[model samples]
Target: MTSSPPGLDLDALRKHLDDALPGLVAGPLDAAVIAGGRSNLTYTVTDGATTWVVRRPPLGHVLATAHDMGREHRVMAALRGTAVPVPAMVHLCSDPDVLGAPFYVMEHVDGAVLRDPESLRALGPERVRNLAFRLMDTLAALHAVDPAGVGLSDFGRPDGFNARQVSRWRRQLDGSRSRELPGIDALHERLAATAPELSAASIVHGDFRLDNTVIDTGRGDRVAAVLDWEMSTLGDPLADLGLYVVYLGTPMPAARGSHDPVTTVPGHPATGELISFYAEKSGRDVGGLGWYTAMSAFKLAVILEGVHYRYTQGKTVGAGFDTIGARVQPLVDRGLAALPREKG
Candidate 1:
């Protein structure tokens, strides 16, 4: 059989389990590849007794400076008691001798990720509206959690986090390997010059989006868990909301390179609506958002360009991604200037 992606070798995996479990018998492990995730290999593993999800680094050489499996595990561990719903982390293996790299096991979170507007339309406007509101509320809860209260003082840097972020993503764009995107570089500079002062320090989900969440249809389409934590950090919580809006507002038609398979809503709810929703739930001041939204666009350009870089280097997982890469830059440019200064 073709080599299973990075972390799912069933035959050899059984050999390692004997030692980790000690007399616990794990029968032939069945692995189903969960596609669409960019950084690591996610496998749905079913051992006769229990089901688990294994997350590990991708098979190739990644920037050693980034992709810390240990950090991800630690953050997940710290989020145990908070309002944010997450798949419980189970075990962590850092020894390369065993899994060839660091990996972690987390409770399997079941749900569907919707991306297509048509599918969303099929779900009907009321359901679409409900999902949108729930998404906002769930994020509000995540951003509202106090870092110190959750035992996450070591989680990130709170001081000068806003200015530092501009510098950080700029470096990411510089390191990316690919075609120069439409307005990526210019937008970066603009965002850097116009970076807004953060109101308070709180947990930030660096990359929050529909696909990064598990939507439990059974709970009236409620979000069950926020899945990816590799990018979670401590910063202005408003940035997380800004990122959510950017992900929802991106021009989907061009980004998909074809009809998007997952249902997605458009025009991203006005920043005011989400701001109001979050304020009602968190009782926090969110006076600044326009600039954060601009920053969101800048970061997205770098991120999408990174994807484009990978696609150009032939590392993308699906068809038509190369074209999608081409489309990302324009949105980056538009989003870079989408917002205007809010009335003071």
Candidate 2:
């Protein structure tokens, strides 16, 4: 588990906000960096009474195109009528004069991203299963949402998404200093050969899974909000489905290995169960998802390799520093295996 950043003073935030907004009650705000997450610096802020969450770029060198808080805010606003639950977006400050970089404020959702064993015990097996199912349902709901209805017809193009994805990621990986990974190339070729048929354009939560979703574990463990829109884009929704299966099914154990054996995965749901649950909820066929899974595996490998590269270059923050970055090879291998074999 990652710890919040230390030494953040509320007085500084209060001063900054009061100077920026003028009349709105700002703070006696306490800012704590929520750890375990990469890509953004998430802080829990309070205005002496009401609480809000703010996200900004991490303290490091970032690509000019990445970490667009404006894109995040806009997506949240456009997803209003969608079945995906999103916290009410409060304010967006692009002017660096406010917080040193672009940032946004939104209604702080009360829930857990980290799994609590005790809390899981209270929720019991049925509710725990419900929690897992709800996440799948929400993703399906997001797919069902019409981008036109939400003023997002231009959000992204789903046309030829599967066909285009192969080249796009390969290009990104190729530009980096990392050695040519066969698994990545192999998976890319396989996906290109067996790309699935495209479907309707839907809101693709680039990252969606248990941790990205805030499940209100009260009487009913409902997903309060699907957070993290930094990578959200319009494209094939199956790509999203494929990612959930990879993280929940393939990556977790492969990530842990035999390093720790006593770990109990609560509700302890597996990938097949969740994917099936999603298919039922979304009314989509699951028979032809090999490409999606393979795509997910290659995508994760590229992402982790990028993390490895950034860490090696000393461009990332402390918690992101890990030997896990070195494991990109196995991810690629597994991803390649996930794809369907070509017919002879």
Candidate 3:
């Protein structure tokens, strides 16, 4: 018999699912926590015949605006017929009584989430190159989506999105402040002082990256589904592109051990190529990306800092968090460097 993972009540979950869907569970539900997520706690729940993925907030110290289950559910549900690939949202439980926090269930997508250089290498250079381009194309397709058409016109305030992002992330950093993050404040100040004008409002995946997507390895390495939509909203599309570039450039510390930076992987397209490809595919001007990239760095740093805060409070549910705090400063440094110099 398998015991329930921390923060998830299997018996209660089984009851809720059955009550909501009726005859969804055929046997006793068993669940195991899935690794890789640093913010939300993800689990794979099964009842012998079927499996599903459950997403909920961190056990403790969750930021007010982050980790919203309803927002995630709504965006994915709205994007079902769009070019963006998202898991089929099954049920969204707003009542926290069922789970300690609001949680949502979606069909388990079968594919690979390539996180490390080794995994990309396994696919060989040609496949890796093709996969990288496809990921960019997918991102273009997402930015091309009309939020109002998808019932998400009010998903987020697009006007002044960048300015609000700077303020919002600064507040987020304040909420998660446990230790002094050198240059982080300065980076934020620079971002605030030089916030770029909105460069086209569209649906932005707040945390878009290659790892957040599931690749259908059996189907020519195509993206099967895009996961982790907690931060999806209407905003400047360049913000999404900027964050993707940061992920490509940054060397993320693995949970167990470090791997080569994503850019070092064989056949991975250069940053310039990917940016140009997006511009051509999306027809959005790629100018002034430095500001967006710097802002993305600051945003990412705050996110990691929040995770660090949770880890310090023993609220985190998995490995890899120990190394998260250390990465914050580097991101800050990168952001500062990416900022455009003031006019003389």
Candidate 4:
């Protein structure tokens, strides 16, 4: 008899699965929290012989238009055979009565999530470099997928996407302003004033990075699955690349016990090289990334602010949240520094 993890009711989940997916639960359920996710709450649940991953919103202070279960399920379900590898969706429970919040279950992907420099270093430089390029190639493949072809023509509005991102993140900042974030407002204003024209619209994974994916080291360092699609939408593809670079540049705080940034690892490709490779692979202009990088920083800063707010309210579900607040200001500064000298 295993006790349920926080924010998940094992009995409720078991009952729902029994009703919706008959005979799926062979035995009583056991669940545990999956760390490393700073935004959505992820859990691994097992019923003796079978296992699956479950994603749900945070406990309290969930922002509007965020942590959408249906959106996450739809995009992944539609991308089953595409070049972009995603976990197989099992079921989506929108009836909050099951988990107190909408949640979806998916097959548990088996692979390594190279989140720290030490993990990347262990692979030696060659494998690390291959993995990085594979990531870039995967992003390009995702960008190459046509929305209308995948029945996602209405996934999002691509026109004025950058402008909407600026306004949306600003509103997100407002929704979670527990403390003053210096330079955040100025960054937002700068982003609003200089939002670039779309550099080509594609299925943008709002948070694209190495850790956000599961690498199948057994398969010659192939990407087994790309996780964390909570922010996926039809928008500027450069936005994904910009955030990927930001992750490469930014390291987690020491207090959080995370290792150095992945960029410092030997064999990791240079930022410029990766960007150029994406340009060559995707056939889209990679110019004017400076503005896109700044926009990514602003978006990340607001996201961390939301997490910090939830931590303050004691609504966060896992560890590593104490230091999240410390990362917000630096992101704000990065956004300001990366802004183009002249608006595009």
TM-score of each: 0.86, 0.85, 0.98, 0.97
> What is the descending lDDT order?
3, 4, 2, 1
lDDT of 1 at 213: 78
Could you say which candidate leads in lDDT?
A: 3
Q: Model 4, range 1-344, lDDT digits (tens) per residue? A: 68889989999999999999998889999999988888889999998799999999989888887999999999999898999999999999999878899999999999988777777888999999999899999999999999999999999999999999999999998998888878889999988988888988899999998888999988899999999999999999999999988888898422234556777789988899999999999998878889999999999999988988988989888778888888899999999999866545
lDDT of each: 0.70, 0.71, 0.90, 0.90
lDDT of 3 by residue, 1-344 (tens): 67889999998898898899998789998998988888888999999999999999989898897989999999999999899999998999999999889999999999998877878888998999999999999999999999989999999999999999999999999999998878888898899999978899999999998889999999999999999988988999999999998988887545234455787878998999999999999999988999999999999999999988988889888777888888889899999999876679
Relative to the unseen true structure, what is the C-alpha lDDT of residue 211 in candidate 4, on a scale of 0 to 100? 84
Cα lDDT over the full model 4: 0.90
129-239: candidate 2 lDDT, tens digit per residue: 667777777888899988888888887778988787777777657655456666576677777777776865677887776667787776377888888898777888888
> What does the lDDT read for residue 264 in candidate 4?
77
- Native-structure RMSD, model 3: 1.1
Off by over 4 Å in 1: 1-3, 23-25, 251-271, 318-320, 339-344
Most accurate candidate by TM-score: 3
CA RMSD per model (angstroms): 3.6, 4.0, 1.1, 1.8
Worst ten in a row by lDDT for model 2: 253-262
lDDT of 1 by residue, 276-340 (tens): 88778878776666678778877777767666676667665534455556556656766657656
